[model samples]
Each structure stands twice: as C-alpha cells, then as structure tokens.
Target chain A: MSGLTLIASYPKSGNTWLRAFLASHLRDGRPIDLNADLSEVPNLTSRSLQDCHAGLEHSDLSRQEVALLRPLTSRRIAREQPGFYKTHDSNLVPPGAREPAIPPDAIDRVVCIVRDPRDVAVSAAAHFGWSLDDSVDRMADTAFCIGHSPRRLNANVEQWISSWSAHVESWLDAGGVQLLMLRYEDLLADPLESFTQLCRFLDLDDTRHAVSRSLEESRFSALAGQEARGGFRERSRTSTAPFFRAGKAGEWRTALPAVLAERVVGTHSRVMARVGYG
Target chain B: MTDGLLCGWRIRSDIALPELLDWQGDDRIPDLVVRLGEVDERLPEGREISPLLQIDGTGAGLLQVPMVGRFLVRPSGGITIAPQPEASEAEIRLFLLGSVLGMVCHQRALLPLHASSVAIDGGAVAFCGPSGMGKSTLALRFAQHGHSVVSDDICVIETCEPPRVRPCFPRLKLWRDTMEDAALSPEGLERNRRGQEKFHFRAPHAGVREPLPLRAIFLLRRAGSGEGEGIQRLAAPLDIMAALEAETFRLQVGHALGRAETLFQARALIANDVPVYRLTRRADAQPDRWLDAIAATIRG
Candidate 1:
C-alpha cells in the first residue's frame, strides 16, 4: 500500500516549493491553486487533540490558538495513502526523549531538504527577521557542534551544515524511515532532473521530459507572476508574497558578510566538502 | 453562624481579597453565601453584595453565582447593613474538599474530564468533545430518553474506589436552543434571564444518585458530504489525542509540576478502559442513533 510521503525539512528549507511543484505536476497539467493553502488539504491537523486531552494538561494554550497539525501527526500512516505535511519544531526530540515523535508505520518516505548552511543562514535571516550573527550563534549552540557570536559570528555556514547533519543522523538512527536526501542547489541547477527523481521516489509515472516542461512552466518567474497577480491564490495561502524566493545558490556569499561566511566554512568544512561545496 | 433564613459560615484566614479596595475585616468574612431567595427579598443593614460574576444564573434571581466557594446568607430588606461572617477561604477549602482535588489529595484520585456523562441501563456513556461541540446537548437528550443523568456538564472519576465516576450537580442545565430543538419536556424548565445560552432543569432525584460504569466514549463531528464514507472509526492515538487536546484544560496547573502527570493518567484511563469512536451525524440527524450504537457496543 502506498503510505504517506512527508515533505520533511527544517523550516524555510524549500518544502513548500517541493509541495507546490508536485501538486502542480500531478494534476492534469493544470497549475495547482494556492487558494486553499496547506490547511484545506484533507486530513490536515486534528483540532480535537488541542481541546479535550491536551487543553487541561496544557491550559496555557487557548482553544483558538492551538494548531491542527500536532494531533494529525500520528494519523499519517493510517491513511490508505501517505499524507504529506510540514513542521518547524526543531526540538522535536527523538522518539524515546519526552513525547513520541511521529509513529514509524505511518511514514513510508521521508524527503529531507539540505541546503548549503550559509544560504540557510541568509534565508533564515530574511524570512524570520533574525540577524545573521544571532542566527548563526543560536544555530551552532543548538547543534552543539560549533561556536556562535552576535557581532560577526562567522560560524553561520558551518552551523547550518551541522544542523542538517544532526537532523540526518537522528532520522537515520530512528530506522524504518526511507530517507531521500536532496540538495537545494541540484534542484536549482536542473529543475527537470530533480523533479523526475522526486516523482520516481513518490512512485509517479510522469516522464522526465514532462516534468522538465512542468518545472519550466512552474519557474520562479512563472510562479512569481502568478503570485504577484494573485493568479496562484487558488493554490497558495499567503497572499502577501510569492513562496518562491531567489532560486540562486550561494546568494548567501554576497548577502552574508565575509566574517559569517568564514565561520560557516569553519564549522561545516567537512560536510560542505561531502556535499561537494568545498 | 445562623442568619435565621440561610446559614452563614465564616472562614478566618490570612488570605486577603486583593480586588476589594477596603477590607477592614480583622476577624472572619463570608466568601460564599448560598442565599435561598431573590436579592430583592432580603438584606441585612450596612452589608455590601455584588451580583454574581461569570455565571449567568438560571435558578436564582442573581445575575451571577459565586465561584468555587463564598459566604451564603440572605440579604435583608435592602438593609445592606450588619457585619456578615467571611468564609471565602473556608468555601474554597470546602470546594477543594468535595472537589476532585479533595479526593486526589486525600486518596490520590484522578479528575474526570469536564464534559457531559449520561448513564444508560448497564453503564454510562460519555460525550467527550470541546466546549461548543454539542456535548451538553447530546447528554441532555440521553437524559430525556429516560437514561439516568450521570452528569449534566462535568463528571468526576474516582479511580481509587470502585473505579466509578460520580456525577455532581446542583441541577441539570440546558441551552435554550437545545431545549427547543430537542422538543424536551418543559415541566421543570426554569428560564435563565441572565444569558441567552443557559437555563436550568432540576435533575430527577432517581438519576442523580444512580452511578453508571462508563462504557463508551464518543467524539462528535458534523457530517461531511462527499464520496468517501462520511464517518469511519480508526484506532489512532493521534486522533484520540487530537480529540482530547481540543478539550484539554490545565496544561500547566497552578505552577505545580505533577499536575501534568495526573492529567496524563486520566487520559490514559479513558484510552485504555473504554472504546472511543468518531460519530458523524447530519444536520437533521437525531443523536439517539449514535447513543444506541455506543450502547450496543457496550452490550457486545
């Protein structure tokens, strides 16, 4: 039976982009509408978990403020087909830690998006309103691999890489989850090839040529045009801005200063080389 | 202390009412006073009283009911005079005494969830859902169907003794709309003028005292019109957690640590002891079908 495919990634790691691409590619060559957003999708988060059992035990959370995703995480594998979803809680401990992570059987495939640590830092800074220095500092501290500083903490890139490494290690240790590693740069380099590989993993039958055409059809310019003119509102939730950011790799090299870049390289030099970024 | 009309109790404690501007009571003061008549009927001279807060009173003429516990005495002839005994502390202490906390503190008991519980012939059926998901409405219907009223709103479970949930109530409450929609008997209906969403129906003495072993837990949902089966049950912990969390109340209770542990234990009891199902019904559907299905499951 086809199980749920989780478009898993650290926040802002292009999970949305992948989802949009797949959704648009799957439909009969029709562009996926962004009108409904992630929530309108079926079997989204269960709102009940927040109220009945979770509330009294967790009264600090208001009924309206609780999220629908926390409760639905366990129901992922139970569906006839795997459900695709996303999350941002980095502290989601290993299954044995405090609360159990997502159940094992529910997940058929786990696709984690790994970007160059420096680029992740830059994207995080712009998207989350975090300064480059603090992002790097906090990131490094969280991964427990390298150092971070506020003023010119150069370890941004290294820490970014280390965070991904830890995430990968944790998922691998968990076992039973089919892991597919994707580099953001590779997708940017050849959208068609990347789309073809992802479709194959998801067990879809669309040809590479068709996927390439679809990718070209759904390019940053095309996607942004739909976003700017509200044409994509049928599929996307956020009306304020396009989900597609700068599709270029190494934008962080120029956006993030030399000091931060040096720190990234210092912390993630080995992983960078492993991913051929050295 | 006897006030001739209603008994007056005073609790002398160090705890002070911070909201009151000038509390000159060096001795004891009345915190909870359950008066029998309307506020207009009785009043002692030089006494201060405020209409009940938070509660839209259905049984009494007062606008609000005292929370937890407070002093109860009749107001005398617009008197607003005389020093009344203060027992806010004693009331809270008594509340916590008869309360689930009282049972737990005394016997390490668990608190039953704050939802509606209905007692059928052999066992009780609990309607567990968020506040506005029609829990009380369904429970009230079950009671009207000659099922014993285990609880109108909140049911307390005492796991230590006989493993039973005691239904506590001064009265059974129903919403105005529910009463109209269900076509329930209006014999004992007391219209609550304070709020549109509340009313009081005195629970029959027979239903109040009878205890039913809880047999089934149902999570209610509106029917979805589609190609798929509108409703199907699945044994998913996530669904249970999701349903329960929608109604979870004390995430962090009173700065205490083990409060969460107690809550988890209560959650586990419902999860382990009873069968839970997601019951979907159309707008015009009667709730008895779902109740009967649960009852059949319990019988099996």
Candidate 2:
C-alpha cells in the first residue's frame, strides 16, 4: 500500500500495547526489548521523524505552520516510508490548517484502540502528572492537544488530539480508508482472539500459534516486567508513576473519584456507549 | 560592509543579520551575496529533495517556507530571497543561515554536520543528535563556562586531512526552560518563530573568528533504563563510517546534487581521521555535569 497504516488512539488508550504486540509478532514472537525494539512501529509524531520528512525543524515552526506542514509531510511519508506508524493525532482539521495532520489519501488503514475514558482519566493522571479531575477535564476539553511543550522541546511533534469523543469519532468515521475499531477491554479479555483479528487486519500471519505466542510475549506482565527492569523511553519525564502501571481495565472503578468519573461520562457518554464502554 | 561573517565567508545581505559576527578580514569580494529579488515559485528542472526544497541540474536549490519567503541558492554563492510580506527579518535570516547555509555547503563541496559545537583548547568538539537532545543546551553550557561557541545547528567542516570546522554564527536556538536553567535571560532576544517560546540567543563576545581543527565528535544519546550513562568511543571502522554518514546535515541534498560519491569520500576521510564517541546521558538533562567531562575528553 502507498499509504500509512496507522495504529491510532487517544493517549493512554492501549496504543503502546498494540505496538508492542505488533513488534513481537513482526519478530516472529521473539522476546522484545521495551526500549530498543519498539521502533519497529515508530511514532508518527516523533520529532526527528517529522523533521526528517518535512525537511524543516518543527521547533522553528509555529503551531499553525506545523499544522499546515504535517499533511504535506504525511503525503511524502505515505509515498516513501509507507508502513505502520503509531499516532495520537485526531482526524479533524486543526485551527488554521486546511486539513488534518494525516489526510485520507495519506492513510492506508487505521486500527484505533479505545479505552474507557474513566480508566483513561486515571492512567492519564498518573502518566501526565495531572490529578484525576485535571485528566477528566482535559479529556472533555475540545481544544485539548499534546506534545506541544510550551516552555521546552517535547520528544514528539505537536499532535492535535481534541476531546476524547472528537478523537474517537475522527478515526472511526474517517472515509476512504479501511478502519478497525477495537476496545481496549476486548484485547484484555481475549488477547488471542483480538490480536488474531489485529494480525489479519494488518495482513500478518493469524494462525493460532502466531497469535498466541505473540500474545504471550506481549502480555502485560512481560511488558511491565521489562519496564520495571529497564525503564521505558516513552514514559513521560513528568509522569508520576511507572509507564506500565496497572494494565487491567476496571482500575478506574478503584482509582477514579466518583465526581471525576461522572465528569468523563458526562462528556464522552455517547462515544463511550457506542464503543461498548457502557 | 557586510552584515555578517559566516564560516570565513563575508556575507553581504539585503536583509539584517544581527546573529552573525562582524566581517573582519580584508574584503576582496564577498564570498556570498544575498539579494532581494522576485523569485519564481519553482526552479527549472528542480527535483524535490525535501518538502520545502528543490534542486536542479546545476545544483541550484529553492526553499519555500509558508510564512517565510522562498530562497534561491545557487552554486556560485548567490542567494536570492523573495520574502513574504509579514515575515520578520530574524525569520528570514534564520533559514538563510540554517537550511540555505547547509545547501551552500553541499554546493561548495564542504561537509555540514547537524551539530552544535564549542572550542576546547582551540580545537572544535561537536555534539550531534536529533532535536531536543540538548545539543544547543550543551553548547550554551560550555559558553557559560568561558569557552567560545563555534556554531549551532549546522557545523561546516572542510574535509581535508585533520578536518577543520569553519566557525559559523554564534546563535543558539534555546527553549525557554533551557534559558532559565542556564541562567540566561531571553528578554529582548528574538524568537525562532512567531508565538514560539524558542529563542535565538546571540552570543556576540563568545564568537570564534577563525576555523578550529575538528577534534572529536560525541554522538549524544539518551541512556535507557538500567543502562549506564557515559561516553564510549566507536572502535569498528564500519561503525565510525556509518556514524559520520548518519550525522551529515542535509545528506539527501548532497545526494540530489550528485555529490554522493564525494560525500561518501568526505565521510570516509572524517571517519578515518577523527575519533567518534557515543556519549549517553540520562533522559533528565544535567548538562552542567557533563561540560567538564566533555572538555577533558576533548583535551585527551
């Protein structure tokens, strides 16, 4: 395919896990290094990657310029370095840009993994050094974005990820590309079946052995153990907790405050219900 | 009189270039001429080497930035700028000295490494890495400790025996936090772009007037978890060759200019002559601690 195959999701929505699974599967279920091997599916918003493709430094560019430049760069990457790329970018057009960061023609397909916003809120609070309330508010904020560190350089480029619902709808409703929407809970409940579907969608070997061995290699315990042994590069420096913290789904029930949970549900209830989070 | 002296080249420009050093040597003719002209949207026979850049058969390149202007860089050291109406002089000069300077290096058959450098005992030591790897931060740190800043972003090197780095501009594009941490004020400094917090800090007194013999290169990298953070020299010949090739600035433009074989020889010469080290630092940046270490390593 002459376009990008995106493993797209909002932050803390099992995007890393999917990449890990794919990384192991691509290596034929070999044990993978948490830091070294994940580059098999590099982040689309990574600063170096964006700079190399755009032929300009994003640090020297304004947010508006970056917004306009991303689509052109995306098309270039689609034509040249076409393959799987992980991204948190929303499909909607950003303010002052003609199109989304990655246009439809630039995309071959998207496998979007969604988590329960309540759980996302809890995990995000730990990962971004925010409180549960702050996380919930950010998830509901229509103007929310990431990787634009105002005072310093972030490792990745600016990704326009609006509200959780807007982000979810952006990829799922996107046209002219193949879309596979999977819930994070489904992957936890049945890794074999879910990853089998994932492999098939990506045109990988979907045999039971292939799926099961890759699943075992990318099991939450193994990944978390690797992270515990050697820290994850993707972990935020400001992150208050481990990157592989609490991989289970219903942690929000115990971790999130009742008021904050209600706030997330109030804003993302429609999208949540549609994705079977209800 | 020209506005700036860059890499021993006297630069006469149609626009302001406050970030560069004053022209010092006897001026026979300007090594580079920058003129304001009506540049066309495209170049004749220009193939797109990058999103903003195109190179023609004569090795002339065109660079078009959306808000900034288009730059036509010819092999004869001529640069024509057709700037946007609202573009700031600082913004225009930034690309002229950055991407355009890199293009000029390829045109002139010089090697440009994407690095930030400072003088250590009259020899240039370079730090190369991806953006946000604190290359400029490290240079700024050394500058604070009384070392002369050699160049930032693109370090121009003559790939002769015992390669020499032509001292370029003394401007460092530092982020807001780096400024605060380095105890430098960004007040009245120019931002790299409009509404961006990154600043183009001019270190006037700390500029090196002459080229320094290229001493060593340290490829800055992050120490992953449980990994040791220190400098390790590259031993294998192929690894050194690969590192030099990887660190070359605007390598694609060199290839597009049909200078790939020359570039390969340049990389081979650098790899054979200079000692390259992989300097792994922890993700948490503490450049002050490594300043003395870098200086000592360079001296050795």
lDDT of 1 at B120: 67
For every prediction, compared with the true complex, DockQ reads 0.03, 0.77
As a whole number from 0 to 100, the lDDT of residue A13 in candidate 2 is 94
Error of 2 at A100 (Å): 1.3
Off by over 4 Å in 1: A37-81, A89-96, A143-162, A172-174, A230-243, B1-300
lDDT of 1: 0.48
- For every model shown, what is its TM-score relative to the native structure? 0.43, 0.97
Off by over 4 Å in 2: B1-3, B204-206
* Tens digit per residue, CA lDDT, model 2, B155-212: 9999888899999978899999999998888999988888888999876455888888
Instruction: Indicate which candidate wins on TM-score.
Output: 2
Model 2 agreement with the true structure over A1-278: per-residue lDDT tens digits: 66999999999999999999989999999988889878989999999999998887888877888898999999999998999999999999999999999999999999999999999999999999998888888998889989898899988889899999999999889989999989999999988888899999999999999999888888889999988887788999789999999998999888888888888888888998888887
Residue clash pairs of candidate 2: none
True contacts kept of 1: 0.06
